[model samples]
Target: MATTALGEYLSARRAQVTPELIGLPTHGVRRVPGLRREEVAMAAGVSVDYYIRLEQGRERNPSAQVLDALSQVLRLDDDAHLHLFRLAGLLPVPVRPAAPEQVDPQLLRLLEMWPDNPAIVLGRAFDILAGNAPAYALFDGFQQGPNLMAKIFLDPDARSFYPDWDEVARYTVAGFRLQQGRSPDDPRIRQVIEELSQASPDFVALWDKHEARGTRMTSKRFHHPEVGELTLQINAFDVRSAPGQELVVYHAEPDTPSATALARLRATATVESPQADQDPGQPASSRSSWSGSPR
Candidate 1:
């Protein structure tokens, strides 16, 4: 029988949960890495045959109660739980083709106003749609490109730029998985996934984990070539004006060493000025360029 997406997800998640994690005894040598099929079914309050059917692609539709119980037994977090529902067709998935991402003029202006904060707009596929001067300075080590996944995974500089490279890579992969779940048919997302899977073994490993999460309010540490070490708090917001666009802002706490470093970096950074003939309403990508050495 052909494997269903829901079945694949359930199987992967189940394998990650060991019997000991859920208070099940290991009476003998176990062949499976996680709980046995019967164990999961009994723990989730479902029959062995029913749970087997669900994992075998014989049962496509599971009620909310069944999914919820299975989710609990699988020890899935909120993001992973939502991903399970999506895989089971319980949540709505976007079917429309993703439109070309364009940052709103108002949003661009807002980014420019915050010279102290590093802000950038990212497309659904993690493309760097637009960024302010400080933002460019912060990411000066990265190659000038649209897609961030390529820069993070393909570019060697990323490893050093982000001191906690392993953690960042895992977080990024999980967030990308969440985005892919929402827009499964998106060609760009598929392209990135395929390209990275072939190029980066690290990316492939994280992708197979099937973790789903989005960028949240968190602090990140960076090793800037010019500014040395700096820690910044990240805040991600959905751009209501443009669907599938996210505005990410990074700020350092006032009076802290990181804040001082950020201020110093922003002051010395030499950002390219917009051309006089260029239309102001055009997306920031066209107006500003990321070139030359880090200033």
Candidate 2:
């Protein structure tokens, strides 16, 4: 990626947004495309001079708090926000060599056994290494990466798939932050960050918040095209055989509507064999089995 000055980026983003976009009124024909320096300074709660110093590169060392404020005032997205912090030299994810993670052969069979539950093994980068029939059906038509982060941020269908998209996205970023912290040197983690940061504006904005909590087991809703709507509970477990892999299982109460919906799904969905790379709905995106999720 090309490097740009932090101040330069701040200035450029400032010029691209309009005052009206942020609830500020415009009185006459405006010469500039975006907010004025004074307006940005006021919104960010920094002195005009201080803000100017930042723009001129006179002040390079901005605290996290200050960057957050400026990022808001600039209307930057999650990816852009994180990029700003990196430009400011604030996000320090050091690179170190590490061993590649391997998913156990036995776990694949276990995932297949769970006909009622949606189960998958996620790699450190949240890649869906392997999933059961129900899990594949649950995510039908949406496989940006077959990786949670890519699916959430890169796929247009994600918003429809997730009812509480924003909330879930926040938790997703928080979970990624925690995992990245644990494996700063993992190349897969770095790859995920780089790919999403470049592709998704939302990911950029949410990432640098340093959200440190991994997603806990929680009940969430999904709008399944075949089944209408279903609420499923998430269960996350560390894969004992794989150092940075996680196993996520999803299920509903036996008698609940969700359970019934899953039953219907199982009937129509093909139980894909590992050899079924030619499965009609299985695209190249679903080819990799790196494990990750918001579970």
| Candidate 2 lDDT for residue 142 | 56
Residue 196 displacement in candidate 2 (angstroms)? 1.2
Predictions: Cα RMSD each = 2.8, 8.1
Which candidate number maximizes lDDT?
1
- Candidate 1, 1-295: lDDT as tens digits: 6778788778878888998889988887889878788999999999999999998999999999999999999998899889889988999997745556566778877877887788888888888777777887777766635577887788778888888888888888888998888888888889889999999998898888787887453988999988899999989999987667788899999999999999988987555422223466876542234542121
Error of 1 at 144 (Å): 6.9
Worst lDDT run of 10 residues, candidate 2, spans 286-295
Whole-model Cα lDDT per candidate?
A: 0.80, 0.74
For candidate 2, lDDT tens digit of each residue in 1-295? 2223666667777887789777888898877778988899988899999888888888889999999999888777675677667667788754434555445666766777788788877877787777777776777675565578888898887888898999889888877776676566677788899999999899998874544465463987888888988889989999876656788899888898988998887786675644245344433232454222222
